[model samples]
Every structure is written in structure tokens, then in C-alpha cells.
Target: MRIRKDYMGFAFLLFLAAANHWLLIPGQVLAEGSETFYPYLLNTALVILLPCYAWEIWRSRGRNDAPLFWEPGLADLGRILCLLGGIWLWADAMKHLGFILPTAFFLALCGWLYGEKSVRKLALLALVSPFVLYALFTMLGAALPQGGIEIWLSPLLVR
Candidate 1:
């Protein structure tokens, strides 16, 4: 039974869920007195989905018969480079600039690529999303990134 690429994604994700549950269950949850069935839940997910994915992939393998590889064009390379540049810029901005700056910058870059034309609208989104997200999560409850970037932005964010 040959495996298809799409089903491969399912398999890998199921593997990840199973792996994490096994590791975290004994390490984090077991130490406490909680009697949660997180491990059983993960095991059920694995047992149910993995065989189904494998069966589907096997059935579809010869039926689909798609091309083995579609080589990346120059535009694909350029887009990847642009994404890399954005990540590099984000890392630098996190250190020197506030989270608001790099985040908005990334959002603006992505939003523009997604075909936003109105400068005013883009600017509003670029600027407002971070605050909205911060407020929505911070006020309503969610964790925010506070990595080494925190040290660099401390003076600006703190004051």
C-alpha cells in the first residue's frame, strides 16, 4: 500500500500529537495528582485516523497519478527570499523596535501581497491589528511572546 502526499501530512500530524502527548503526559501531568485522560484521547485519535489515512492514500495512489514534482519557479524563489527577508527584519525589529513595529511591518508586507490596494485601509490594518490582537488576547486572556525580544524592547515598552 503506497502512501500519498496529502495523507502523509495527516500521518505526520497524528504522529506529532501522539509523540507530544506521550512525552508531556508523563513529564508535566503525571507529576501532579490529576487523573486526566489526555493520553487515552491522543491514543484514540492515533488509532482511528492513522489507519484511515493510510487506507485512503493506498486507494488513491494509482488513481490520482499526479506529477511527482513541480519544480519551484523563479517567482517561487523570489517569494521565499522575501519571506526570509521579512523574518530577518522581524528578528532585528524585535530587538530594536517595539513588538508593534515588526508585527505591523510583517502584517503590512503580507497584506500587500494578498492584494490590498488602499493605502489608508492597509495602514489602518497594519497599525490597528497588533493593538486589537493585544487587547483581544491580553484583556480577554492569552499568552504573548516575551522572549529575548523583551529585553531589547523593555525600555520602550516599559516606559
Candidate 2:
């Protein structure tokens, strides 16, 4: 049977959730009844994202709206190439520039890719997105993903 793409994504997400929980099982609870916060947080995030995904799967089960997966035809490989190349460059530059600059560029470029064409909108997105991340990490103590950006940016942004 040809499986629906949404099902495949859901399965992949479930597998990741399982893997995350398995990896953290030994750490979250101690034999002496102490608890580690890191694993608990990780497992919580994994579990949390699943329901949103499940809700999407339920909502989209019957509708033929836009394509679930963007299949860009033959010449569409160019976008893939650009995407990978940009990611590579972003990784290489992370140590020097930090997350904010590169992430802004990446976000704006992606918006452009999806046909967004307003300079004001792009500027706003590129600026506001990073601050939103910083706020989330600072206020909520959320574990934000980083490559090497923190090495340079942290000293300037945080005490």
C-alpha cells in the first residue's frame, strides 16, 4: 500500500519521540528517587510536539488542499541545492557571526523562496525572529539549538 506522506511524517515523529524517551529513561529518574530536569524537559518537548502533529494529521486526513510535500519537479533541485549550500555556509559561519544574523538571513531567504516579496515584511521577520528566540530562551529557560554562535554572541548579549 502507498502510504500517505502525512502518515510517514507522523511515523517519523513518533520514532524520534520514542528514541528521545529511550535515551532519557535512565537519566530522568535516579535509583535514590532524585530527578534530572534536562531529560524531563527533553521528553516533555518530544511528547508535546506529537499531539500538534497528530491534530494536523486528523485535520488533513480527507482534504485535497495544497500539496503536503513540496515536490518541485525536475529543475526544483536548484532550491534543494541552495538550501543545503546555505545551511553549510550558515554552519561554517556560526562560530563567527552567532545565531541572530545567520538565522535572519536564512529566514528571509526562505521567505523569498516561498514567494514572499515585501521588503518591510522580510525586514521585520529577520529582525523580530531572533529576538523572539532570545526572549524564549532567556525568560522560559528554553533549551535553544545552537551551533557555535553562542561562543561569540553570548558575551555581548548576556552577562
Candidate 3:
């Protein structure tokens, strides 16, 4: 039987998952109780789900009626690359400019790039989402990289 072209992407992701499970996560020394829980849970889920996904894909391989992969046009490829670059830039900018501003700008830019025509909705989403995420992260006890806005606003939030 011929291997499906879609399997290539799945293989790559499976390899990454394996590497993450074996090489990376094992090296991190966790704290006492709950800190180790998520990694173990993720590993278990990956172990179970990946094989199920592979099985489903294998079972579906006989059906030639539907296309397995969508061939993206050049414009789609360019937009995907731009989105990736934007994510990298946003991550870097968050270190220096803080989470809110960079996240807001990235959200707006992504919305515009992906063909959201309503300027007011885009503006509102761009403005509101970052703060909401920041608050969520803060409440969850995840320490985020801080800059001017975070520095100022953190005092007011008071844990």
C-alpha cells in the first residue's frame, strides 16, 4: 500500500511529540505536587490520542473520493509565512514592550490580514483581548514578561 502524502505532516508532528516527551520534558525538574501533573497528563494524552489519530488516518486512506490535502496557493503560503513572522515578532516585542501592546497590535494585524473588514470590531478585539488574557494568566499564577504597562497595571491588580 502506498503511503499518503498527509502522513508526512503527521509523522513530523509525531516525531516532535516523541522528542518533547523523551528529550525535553524529562529534563525539567518539577516542584512538589501539582507542578508535575500537567506534563504527565499531556504525555498520557499524547500516548493515547496520537495512535488513535494514526489509526483513523490509516482507515481513511482507502477513500479516494475526498482530497487529503488542500494545495495552498502562493497568496495563502505568503499569508501563512507572514503570520508566522508576526508571531515571532510579537514574542520578541512582548519581552521589551510587554504583553498588552504587542498582543493588541498582533491581533489587529492578524484580523486585518485574514480579511476582517470591520475596523471597529477589529479595534475592540485588539484592545480588549490582551488585557483579558493578561488577567487570565495573572489569575492562573503564570508569570508573564513585564514591561511598562504590566509594571504599572500589576500594582493595581494586586495578585
Candidate 4:
């Protein structure tokens, strides 16, 4: 069977997922109950899903009769650059602004850049989602990186 580029990429990911499930995830669990459960559950799901992905990729091999694709156009390149720039900005801002503010801004900026013009919905998502994620991760005992904003808010957050 001839191995196409798409097949090679899918196989690489499948191998990676399986390896992480078997090797990395088992050592990373620090707690015996909830902390252990999520990682194992997710890794098991990925391990199961990856085999199905591999099978589908194998089954569909060489089905695309299209010739080798041309290089992406300048517009496509510009959008890719814009996405990278946005991500870089988000990371830089997060160092000082913390996860919540930068993530909200990043989400709103991404929505706008991708042509989603619903201001109300974007605003709601921008305002609410980050706080929810922060709370969820805190509840799950994940140590979020603290920035200036988080440092300031830590006193209020302490129970």
C-alpha cells in the first residue's frame, strides 16, 4: 500500500496519541480520585479514537483523485499570519494580564477576525467564558499561572 502524505500525518498523530496514553499519562497523575480519573479517561478515549481514525484514513487512501495541491494564495497566507500574530499577542498579554482577560480578548478578537459579527454574543462570551474556565480549573486543582491580575485578585479568591 502506497503511503500518501495525509496518511503519513494521520499515522504520526495516531502513534503519538497511543504513546502518550501508555507512557506519559500514567506518571502524571498526582491524586487518586478525580485528578487521576480525568487524565486516564481522556487518554483512554484518545487511544480508542486514534485507531478508528487510522482505519478511516487507511480505508480512504488514494480516494482523492486531485493532483498535488498548489501553494496557498497570498490571502490565505495573510490570514495564517494574522492568526499567528493574534496568538503571539495573546500570549504576551497573558504574562501580565493573566488568563482571564487575555483569553477573553483573544476569543473576541478571533471571532471578529473570523467574520463573526454578533457583538452581543461575542461580548457575553468574552465576559463569561474565561471566568468559568478559571473556576473549573481551580476546582479541578490545576495550578494556573498567576499574572499581575491574578496576583491582585488572589486575596479576594481565598476562602
> Of the candidates shown, which would achieve the greatest TM-score relative to the real structure?
3
TM-score of each: 0.44, 0.59, 0.61, 0.56
Residue ranges of candidate 4 with Cα displaced over 4 Å: 1-72, 148-159
Clashing pairs in 1: none
Query: Which sections of candidate 3 miss by over 4 Å?
Result: 1-69
Candidate 1 C-alpha lDDT tens digits along 45-95: 777777787676666666647324335567756876987799788867765
* Tens digits of lDDT, candidate 4, 32-146: 2335555667567877787687777667756776224335567756877898898899878876777888988988987877688999989998988887877766665654556
- Across residues 1-159, which tens digit of lDDT does each residue of candidate 2 receive? 345667777787788778656753553244324344655686789789989988888887668772266444655567768877887887566556666778889888878775789999999998899767755554444333344655455555555
Model 1 residue 45 lDDT score: 72
lDDT of 1: 0.63
Quote the RMSD, in angstroms, for model 1: 9.3
Candidate 1 runs further than 4 Å off:
1-71, 140-159
Give the range of the ten consecutive residues with the poorest summed lDDT in model 1.
137-146
lDDT of 3 by residue, 52-133 (tens): 8788777877697523564567897799899999989997998799889999999998998889999999999999999998
Instruction: List clashing residue pairs in candidate 4.
Output: none
lDDT of 2 at 61: 69
Pick out the ten consecutive residues of candidate 3 with the lowest summed lDDT.
Answer: 28-37
Ranking by TM-score: 3, 2, 4, 1
